[model samples]
Target chain A: MRGIILKDLYDNFCIPKNAAFYIFGALAISIGFFIPSEYYYVLISGVILPLFGCCALKSPTEQEESSSFNKLLITFPNSKAQIVTAKYLLGLGFVILFNFLALLWSMVQVYTHHTIRLTEALRIWGIGISISLLFLAVIYVGFFLLGKRNGTIFFITITCLIAVVWGASSALLGIQTILSCSPGLVICLIFSGAVMIVLSCLVSIGIYSRRYSTGTKNRY
Target chain B: MDYAIQVKNLTKTYKDFTLDNISFDLPCGTVMGLIGENGAGKSTFINALLNITSAQYDQVTILGHDLNTQIKLIKEDIAVIFSDSHYELSFTPLFVGKMLSKVYKNWNQKKYLDYLKRFGLPEKKRLKKFSIGMRVKLEFAAAFSHDPKLLILDEATTGLDPVVRNEILDITREYAKGKDRTVLMSSHIANDLDRIADYIACIHEGKLLFIRAYDELQNNYGIINCSRQFLDTLSPDDIAAYRKEAYNYRVLVSNRQKLKSVFTDVWIENASIEDIILFYTKGEKIR
Candidate 1:
């Protein structure tokens, strides 16, 4: 667990592209927030981060490093579960950090009259991160379930399906009216988001194990 | 004592190619050079040992641990270095120092710095911009910094200029400072392996032709040049493989002395690993 965090933070994120990712994320999120749009920032960050993140995972150039690093990680004196946990935890850590930063920036917007109140901001973050995690979940499932090639395509397809569903559902049932009067909406959304994140994460774990077992047979 | 690596009935079937029943062993503290063409399954073999992709685990074990259940333990003692640079090549070397230090339990900062100085790599320069030789040097430094007992290298020494290749070879030799250390390397540059590898395993078209001590392979294997009339006098069983080219006959033999018993027209020449591989895989011209 310690090993994965150290590698992800130090080896992966301390360089040029990493800074670019955070900087671009901040810029993209800021643009969405200041635009006075309906779920624009939330939607953009939700769709873009996961979409690009999956692309990053399957990047051909990244394979040179990933395969080697993964080789090192598997060989370490730890369980695959531990390695998986560490990687997910690191992903979790980064996502949480991004959430905090996103919240802080949103708070600044609220202070300046560009965004919603504190409670609304909290709800937005909760929903936003859940959507992003769903994207991540799809990415994980793709990598571990179908191998990198099929996985990227599957992830994109799933993301597109979600977008289509969201658009169609929103057309039929407006989001603002549902949330305007009911306090229960906030609690239900939180519970739903939490359940989705946990379920997606767990499904990814199952995919990862099955993938490893299959890989073990054909590789040797 | 059992060999460090033990593979029994190991097989992998790809759609187009099959790595069929591959098996070999390296005694502890010895270096084995895996020689093969580009698609000869060298990387596949290394990947299998590391348990990277889904590969057979029940039949292969290293360092006395079950490959399936004990891969992590094997990996802790074993280090792998591929030709590609794994560290952030765009950061200062110091960043590499910090990044790798935390992951490896026995990470030695002083040792890393010493290797940097020894390899003549700049500490402040970003690695992505370094010369290929320097990048390779940095990779070796990091792999060695961790106190690993086995080093599995997949063409890690390929493409470097000769002098740097020699330097890398020397550094690999130093990593074996302790008698218990071992290295398994796959290289196209036979000269490099010829200098350092104690054992040689030649793989071609997903099959292992042979794995033997470097000295024995070099000493026992030879290319016997003979004429058509002479070839007619010799039997196929007397030679490993004989080719009838336009002007002459090139015969590969396991024992050079066998040439004397053949027709007097036979001319036996000492064969290098390259010669053995070329003749074995492509059927080199005897003339």
Candidate 2:
């Protein structure tokens, strides 16, 4: 399992060019938002954080298709379920790594400028990461079930779901109810995130097992 | 005889095609060549053996283990190479070697590196930059590095140049020289199989047409070129296929020894594997 996850990371994230582009792009984007100094942290975090999640969502499947390596992956000694589990775990790893880095950077900014309170930044980071987790769970299930070709359809469906959730919660309950950083709300979010991860993991494993067991699609 | 691969009543169906009840056995320590025209279920047959695709089977076993139930255990000792390279384009030989080291328990890093050096592949060059032949060589290197007991190659040499194709065939032949090693390679290039395979299995239209020893085919099959008038005197049962043009008739005989006395005046020559395939697939059957 460690080897499998390592291979996935090696394939998707080990490129120097991609690393440079993301890092430099984030720094350049952050510096470009200089007009409003007070909004610097918010702008940078908003742009880079979701981009990180999207990258996490997109990398493995896109690389699997373009490289034609997924066909070879099944030929490995690992079981089908193991491969799916490794992928989900790799995604989780990425989510954790990205959110942690973002939190650390936010801490540095708060330390230097003191414009944002530590708790406020922590809450924002928590909410953003939780939302990213939910987003990834849905994307992971879609990619596993429909494969790479229906990626656009999956993205559209996810976008619509996000929009519906926002509209319904904001209209019926209140925006504050959804955005509040209460302990109860945080616990609820964590439980739901855990549930989504577990459910997606199982479904993805089933999807991959059926596909590989039947030898249906060779590339994906 | 101890068989390395024993497939029985294997069937796979698509909307328009069905590999119906295919069965054949490949003995241990020998190479078996699978030959077929496009869409004749050659790839499907190979994929079924690898369990890369699911097929209905009464029983399928590889290396003494059931392919369906014990594939995880079986795969450790089996190596497979498809027609195209199945590696990431961005990966170099060094990276691939590192990745595979964890996948195969018997992976020999030294052997893999030796293959890379022998194949003239640079350790740091990305696979996307390698020529098609080089990419295939990389795949072969990886396959060989694991020291698998059974190698399943599906058209692995199809698009390679003659020199590279011959080299690949030689590698397979050497790989099968071990005490228990075996190979099942599929190709339309019958001459390649003729040079290395111990047995040849021909499939046509999703059916196993014939699975015979290579020596038996060489000894029994022959082609006779004679006048149309002389062909009329021969029995149709002896003629597997025939083509008539102008004043002559060319007949492919399945039992060449029997034809010697039956067609005493006709000149018969040994049939090449290519000639045999052409006759079976394209020539008109005598009866």
Candidate 3:
């Protein structure tokens, strides 16, 4: 499992070829710096952070499919459970990293300009982490179940649907009202996201194992 | 005798094709060459053996371990190489070595580095920058470094130049020098197998045509070239398969010595592995 994770990291993140992705991440961070403090959490946590997290989770699966590395992976000494768990662990690690960065940036904003309180920033961070976890769960399940091309389409469609619904709800209930109720809502989201993530991991392991047994090209 | 790989009643079916009930055993300390034409299920067979593809099998035992219950343990002692390199293109050989070192318990870092150096592979150069031949050499280096008990190659030398292919064959031969080591290489390139194989298992249209000793094939099998009238005189029991030409009949006979002694005037030539495969695939059944 450590070897598979290391291989994925080497393929997707720790390589010079993916320097462009790092630049994109830096650009997302820089873009967040200029947004109004009141809307900072909205833009960074709601949009930019989830988008970045999704890309982080998606790239390794895409590379594995394009290169047929998954076929090679099954030949390794690792079990199917180990292979599926490694990807989930990586996704969880990225979600934590993204949340940490968001908190750090939020601290900078709070100290530099006293617009948002630290406690409020923490709440926003919690919500952001929850949303990212849910998003990761959905996309990971899609990639493992539907494969690369269909999975990408499914993810994009789901993202668009969520955006449309979120926009409609925000317009109807108002942004300030949503923020006021978010403390309790954030807890619910976190609990639901954690459950979804666990379910997604188990489902993915079953899907992957079935693919090998049935000789289906589910991911590869 | 101990077998490195044993399969019984193995079958995998698809919408268009099926690898029908096939069974064979690759004895320890020997190279078994699997030969078949394109789309003939050589890869499917290997995949089934490695549990890469789910297939129905009554029994499959590799290195004395049951394949279904103990594949993970079996995988640790085996190395497989396909025609294409499965390593990440962005990774340098140095990084690959580091990554795989954590996967296989028996991975030898010094031996891996030695192989990379010996193969003239650049440690820091990414695999995408290397040629196909170079990438295959890298895979060989990795396969050998782990000291696997069994090495399985699926058309691993197909696209290489003759020189590099010969070099790989030499390395494979050396790897099998260990008394416990075995190799099961599947290739349409009959010449490579002819040089190194101890047994030849021929598959034609998803069926096992024959699995005979290489020595028995060389010494006993013969292609008889004779007129139609002369062919008619030979017993059907002696002719395994035969193809007819414009003016004569070419028959594949398994008992060359017996046939030669019975018909001293008939022209009987030694059957190469390629000839045997061609006769089996293209020749009509004796019946």
- Per residue, candidate 1 scores C-alpha lDDT tens digits across B84-104 of 435544556776687667667
Sliding window of 10 residues with minimal summed lDDT for model 3 chain B? B83-92
lDDT digits (tens) for residues B52-159 of candidate 2? 778888788888998767878888988888885378788888988998898899999999999999989999998889988898889999999999988988899989
User: Which residue ranges in model 3 land beyond 4 Å of their true spot?
Assistant: A15-17, A34-36, A157-172, A214-220
lDDT of 1 by residue, A141-210 (tens): 5665566567657866887887897677557776553224344665565566557656766776666555
Per-candidate Cα lDDT values, in order, are: 0.68, 0.79, 0.84
Residue-pair clashes, model 1: 11
lDDT of 3 by residue, B1-287 (tens): 49999988888898998998899888999999999998999999998888888888888889999888888898899999987537878778998889889899999999999999999999999888998889989998988878899999999999999999999999899988887899999999999999999999999889999999999999998998888887788888888899998888889998999988988877789999999999999999866
What are the candidates' individual DockQ scores?
A: 0.35, 0.42, 0.45
RMSD of each candidate relative to the true structure: 5.1, 4.2, 3.2
Off by over 4 Å in 1: A10-13, A17-21, A24-84, A98-183, A205-220, B228-238, B257-267, B283-287
Q: How does residue B286 of candidate 3 score in lDDT?
A: 61
Candidate 2: stretches off by over 4 Å? A28-51, A109-112, A116-119, A149-180, A215-220, B227-237, B261-265
Give lDDT: candidate 1, residue A120.
58
Q: Say which candidate scores most in TM-score.
A: 3
- Candidate 2 lDDT over residue span A112-154, tens digit each: 6665667666655666576667777888888888766797488
Question: How do all the candidates rank in terms of TM-score, highest first?
Answer: 3, 2, 1
Q: Is candidate 1 or candidate 3 better by DockQ?
A: 3
